[model samples]
Target chain A: MKIKNILKGAVFGVFAVSGAAHAADVTLNALFMAQAAYSEDDIRNMTADFKAANPGVDVNVELVPYEALHDKIVLSQSANGYDVVLYDVIWPAEFAQYKLLDDVTDRIDDKTRKAVLSGAWTTVEYDGKYYGMPWIADTKFLFYNKDMLKKAGFDHPPATWEELETQAKAIKDKGIVDYPLVWSWSQSEAAICDYTTILSGMGGQFLDADGKPAFNTGGGLKALQYMVGTINDGVTNPNSREYAEEDVRRVFSSGQAAFALNWGYMYNLANDPAESQVAGNVGIVPAPGEAGVSKASAVNGSMGLGIPTKSTHKEEAWKYIQFLTSQKVQNKYAKLSLPVWEASYSNPDVIKGQEPFVNAAKTSFAVMAPRPTMASYQEASAVLQEALQNAMLGTATPTDALNNAAKTIADLQ
Target chain B: MISYRKTVTAWLLLTPMIVIILGVSGYPLIKTVYYSLTGAKLIAPDLTDAWIGFGNYIRALSSSNFREAIWHTTYFAVISVGVEMIIGVMVALLLNEVFVGRTLLRAMLILPLALPTVVNAMMWRLIYNPDFGALNALLVQLGMLDAYRSWLGDPATALDMVIVADVWKNFPLVALIALAALQTVPKDLYEAATLDGAGMWNRFWRITLPAILGPLSVALVLRTIEAFKVFDIIYVMTRGGPASSTKTVSFYVYQEAFAYMRVGSGASYALIVVLISACLIAGYMYLIRKHGEA
Candidate 1:
């Protein structure tokens, strides 16, 4: 039957080639940016499935380097060169601030709307208007090398920062590892995520309840100081200051670090025996708590899809967006990877029989903190990251750096 | 009459470049200037763009963040350019001498100038890494410090480290340019200066220096302009970080526009950067023209 289908496909191909001049083709220009998640096969399958779902819509999904996507999308949006593009959850405010995408609340049907993860709609919402639907839940979590911990007399991941420090120090001192813990300390989005972990676990707010840059308060200071203290105590690698997520991943994947505070997407990499030095020797858990509170790793990894306000094919684009974000398609994506839909989370296929993702899905949703919603969060985060980096390097004390960062962020407002 | 026609033809030949300039740069300049005047938030839903006349300028001027950014940026330019030029000139002069392996040395000196800026930034950022970096490892082994110190991670060392990286990366460009111009200077002039009781320093100051001054000044201006707009390395390595000790004007503009949704504010600050850059370029051009007249 497969051979017969292949022959039939070849005949169709020959017919299409012969009738190319007469038949009008529809091309849907699209963008896919998954820097930390999704292998090439994952992207190819996703693209293929998308094309299959809409047989007539010839989707041209070209992958771009994640770094260039934002600048390119924003710059192009001003002139209407790009029709539809993927966006990180953090970017909707900036995009909506520019009035780039059309409101999609009306376009999305009840079924599609309900299928998406709760609060997912609010993520892309700006000023009480819907813009994009979530693509995935790219949250952060704590990952530990179970084998390393077994070697060092521990059964499970650390429950508190204090426990983490003790185990990390024990491992480091005994020469179990050169550096026992690692995190994304690079001065980029990763820094923002790391800060989220520290701040949330310590019960700190990045900004006040009244929408102000409010990280210099008691809670905020304690959070910043705790993260800084981990390095001061010589637990994590100090070069974490310069580590991009990949650097931390490399260290963790090599089976060196006993504990890694990292993104949720690294589960596959940490457990693939062919790729990871310590495959199946890993245990993933929610990040450590502080102030008797569970750690809240910042929500990232998800891309939001929206129609451009000036799009010539607004109706068609909306239809595509609606269809793609439907429960059925969302379930299919979950089959491929964890789709950012409430229905997909409970889908039996997502785990492939893994307990960690199941635990993460349950725990992460309870404490998943999205990047701050304020329009100036990006700039504020950049300033704050620089300050944290400074403190980590001992160039300035955390108090001094946070004070300076606070002053700088307040100036922007 | 024929000369006039020929002039017209020459102008017609140059018209393509003018069209390109207007298309590529001129339009954005005009648009940016317009946006700078009116508060153009790139993503705001409100249709009524409040044309607060000079509001952006007032805000930018009063902005403490902008002030600190300008201060840090200028300091970087002054410090990095000074260091780079002096070192570059010295290197150029050393390479200018007829030494063993001159060909190989000249090629090797240009290697850093050849590497892409992003690669250079990544490589240097790695070397400057606090843990597992060669610098910290060497320092620890040598007992220079009790622990690893991240060079670009601390606010105090971040700026200086960036300056060092910038100088290390850029001094070679200046040197290569200076070297080319130095080689063009007749060697007999140096021999003449030497015969006239000019010692080593005297020969360099009286003869060699004068010959290369014109080209070197041009190189200095170019280097200064490039250094003034230091964005990528700072953006990549530290990201104006360690509490923004290295935030240059370009990075600030980028942050304001893209990071913050303050588009009008960003455009105005961009104009400020443009005005400063224009003045610097004009001064350099004036110096070059003056040297030509001299």
Candidate 2:
């Protein structure tokens, strides 16, 4: 009887030990934007790779629409559900102020610092502390329809806003198209980006060194006047006031517009025969300047990969971030999203695939200025978008519009 | 002693409902009121949550945007509900009569009412698109105009365009209510009027109108409250743009709380809206009660 009792106790001990070990394995939930930057299959594959390397961890990714991602992140932070969040570049300062992100300042070593684009680092750092891993490095590109330009008797894309208008007028007169330009001028975040590109190219800064609104200056008015002038002159689509980026891309991709302004990802989609009527005929260049004031300056449109402060699996999340941002993984996914790694810009394979986009990015990077990085960025952006829309629609002149925006921004600050 | 026991039993019976109401509605209301007195933010701590003692209220009162939003909300509610009532009663009267395909026509009439608000808004947005939209295409095809029109893009027409869309989506509800009220009007009353040598218009004014007035008033009050708090359609369509022409009070609160993240200001704004809604409801109830008594 004693021997049988001992044997039973030993078997029970063995079962309990294994069960405890199984329960100790960690599972993480990640929130990502449902954008074209990464395909579901690619995300799944990357997670599978992570799982194989670390067998004790399981990851579940939830895809959210771009518009809903911010709200979802905030809700999940309060509920303590999401372990990792893919955040926009403009959100870090605000999120950091809320203490919603884990400080990964120490995690980002000197090697990682040297590897990424210098501009990308500016996005994820707040108050001298790093909050995220630089994942995407993005900028806007000037996309033109080569066929439309050739039909309009132009061999090259316009280098200046004046040249663009001249070409647009010629195209309209020649009956090539009713509107030679299409813009994403809707009152959304994209409007701020487009306006920033134009504003910076005309040597205008959104704010002075003291962070007061300086967009009411001469250069700012000129930029606004030029953009609204194109529409008034019937060179750009009249419906541009209602268009978002995708709407503008559609017009250009359908062979209806001579020029458009869109992000780097549109290059692939616009060249794909399945999606575009102007396949193999799309030409990319720097956005136009005001002829002599400055060169075309692209606005930075990057996002960061960050671990939420409420995450219990912070160590595991860091591991995931490291794996996701490694040179090999970023290189493998370069076609879907541009790599943050500086070295990848010179990779022969990357050069072969995205030469035009990379070349424009190079010029844009040298002259790029970041969006207003403030905790009240959303308010500032809304104010600017409304002002730009008013200017474009002739509800208010550029001077009046900027003055109103300045007052609002001053109050918000 | 027996009465006291019965009172205890009654209180016990009502306990669950009271608890549920407190949990679902009372708590949020209390929280909103509390936040309104403090400087709070949706995402970040605002000024350490210390009481500001009507600071937010003063700001809201001083802001020109808030005044404009109030004007917009009132304008939208009055015009939309007024137009909807007239059209709804007429449609209800038309549909109340027996016809060959009465059942199918009744079903088709209520289809718009069955659609989700967001879906209806999106459908209208597509229809109102300046380029290749159905409205422009149909108008041009019918030779109503020579060129395509930016119906929603133009500020002069933006709010009215939204009102039209809202009417199309919402009139069916008012019609359904009116139709129900119309059913209650006695056929004997109409027959008596006809025997008295009364014409169609007289019968409508004397019998049909009075019979449906109470129910139509109820429908009006309900839709008026809803129209005053309109946000989803505006968000999906104009985003309160063309120079803030359609910025309703509810949209202003939404922008404050979610977009600008100023929870304190937003909460104060919401309480103000609720007060307005309460006054409107109270006045409507008094008028209806007086009419009923008369």
Candidate 3:
């Protein structure tokens, strides 16, 4: 009888532990990129805060490089994949087509929609439906060395693309820097971002009314020509053909380049004395536009956090995303990436040390151009990346390269 | 009846391994072949509706980019494996001799081979950095180079640079294999060859060469298959950049399936790679059979 009693007690103990686990504990897995925008530590701390507020809910975060982020998200879909994934602005069409992300249109309310910046909505919106919440409101900005400019006899930063080139030439002639300009023109999405900035500034369209390739002529042709011209004139760094965004930042921060085209995250890092050699000499401005086209240029390089369709703990995952994108959380960690909420721009804490960044962002966010939104955007981008590299490497003329890319992308459609 | 019982027990003991092998590799291989014939989307729920036989193969064969990738893979495989074999045998012959610190040198040879390919690739990337790399610094300081130049960034030198890194990490493996084969060669053979008035080159060409050829060929076939499927090193080092100059067949398949989300076409490309690897494997089996007969 005593042995039977002990056995009954053991069975009851196992039941009690498992019963408690099934009731309240929900662990959500989130996938995030390690580069740019929000730092990994900030995401972890924010997730920790969310967990503290909601007892028995935990978030396991995994970070990957931006180049590997897309593949990881897709590969994990067939399995019990990530509950939450951070997606690039260019991926919504592809993700929605494949049903990789859950449609959260009903979860997002009008109040939240109105609070966030209008441009940020584009990051998660596809086919008039919302797939996720925009967390990173970003665009490329022109970073210049004020000391180099001053030494080259310039009082103000360039206001147009031609003026920027003239200043770069002046800087180069004055021996301020061997390569006055550095760009992320490597054969990747980064090169596309830079190309889009110039193309948008020159008033180019990626597609026509019938969704045909339109980037081969007019302003698109001019943009590629200008890129090739800089390289040919010995003003742009030759090594930039292998550079990505981080490389551009490194070259700029080391005082090797007088001017660079990079994202908003570089503004703070480039200004921090601990991280940059040319800290105090860094200056920020919107990317210059063409003489007759526009005032400034930018590309829609934002990212969003979404729940994948295969996630089991989606309710808890959505809660975590909401908390992370909440105004309070975003404002607290606004050093690296600015918040998507429009009201946070007026918040003194957000603007205290980043006044120039905020000022440039105000202009840039309005004019940020979107890359072509299609299900085959990745393939299209690859073709364009090669074309850009071909032109930059002098293997083909800019016109020929752009035409070939247009033909290939047209076939992809 | 006793022998029959023993055979039954043996079959029972091997059942788990057979099941495991079929589950892990056999199932995936069959599924890949099935997917290659169908027009399946990677993320789609239903895969039964889209079947287009031989279409993906034709498309892959027609693409210039895929053809270029095949050429690149061929070039990488031939050069890296050929160089590795030559260097490996030389190192093995040298180490086979009576020398001081032979044990220490053998241990050191394992270092590069033991390092993970990703780590090796990353180290080589840093070493090849155009602006501040150790290579450029050394070359400039030695008065061999006029200035710092991009090594992996230029299309003309990127693939060759990657080959150099691959050889560095993998030649040690071949050396170790060759060294083991060399030890089994009888001391009497070299003594006999020298007694017959053979020179160092002749002895190496006749006795040493034949003794190590069997193991060396095995290493050659294995390295050839591996070098043809090179992805991680290229992925980490240059990402097929400066105009896709270093893209191999594996990288092409990865992009087609994962990046582009065309599962059906990607499967076809992957099967083509497998077919090529299978051919090499068949050649390996034939060589081994011939060696056994000899």
What TM-score would each prediction reach against the true structure?
0.83, 0.93, 0.96
Indicate the worst ten consecutive residues by lDDT in candidate 3 chain A: A18-27
- Report lDDT (CA) for all predictions: 0.75, 0.86, 0.92
Task: For candidate 3, state the interface root-mean-square deviation in angstroms to 1 decimal.
Answer: 0.7
Off by over 4 Å in 1: A1-23, A52-56, A62-69, A126-129, A173-175, A206-209, A212-215, A290-302, A313-337, A343-348, A390-413, B1-34, B43-49, B94-111, B126-149, B278-294
lDDT of 2 by residue, A259-305 (tens): 88877777878888998999899998888876668778677778889
Could you report the DockQ of all the candidates, in the order they appear?
A: 0.36, 0.42, 0.83
Runs of candidate 2 exceeding 4 Å displacement: A1-27, A35-60, B44-47
Total clashes, candidate 1?
Answer: 8
Q: In terms of docking quality, how is candidate 2 classified?
A: acceptable
Candidate 2, residue A183: the lDDT equals 81
Cα misplacement distance, residue A117 of candidate 1 (Å): 2.8
Comparing chain B with the reference, what is the TM-score for each candidate? 0.93, 0.96, 0.95
What does candidate 1's lDDT look like per residue over A273-360, in tens digits? 7778878877877777764565544444456777667666665566566566556765555522466666556667765656676677
lDDT of 1 at A324: 62
After superposing candidate 3 on the true structure, give the runs of residues whose Cα lies further than 4 Å from its correct spot.
A1-22, B1-12, B45-49, B291-294
Q: How well does model 1 score by local distance difference test?
A: 0.75
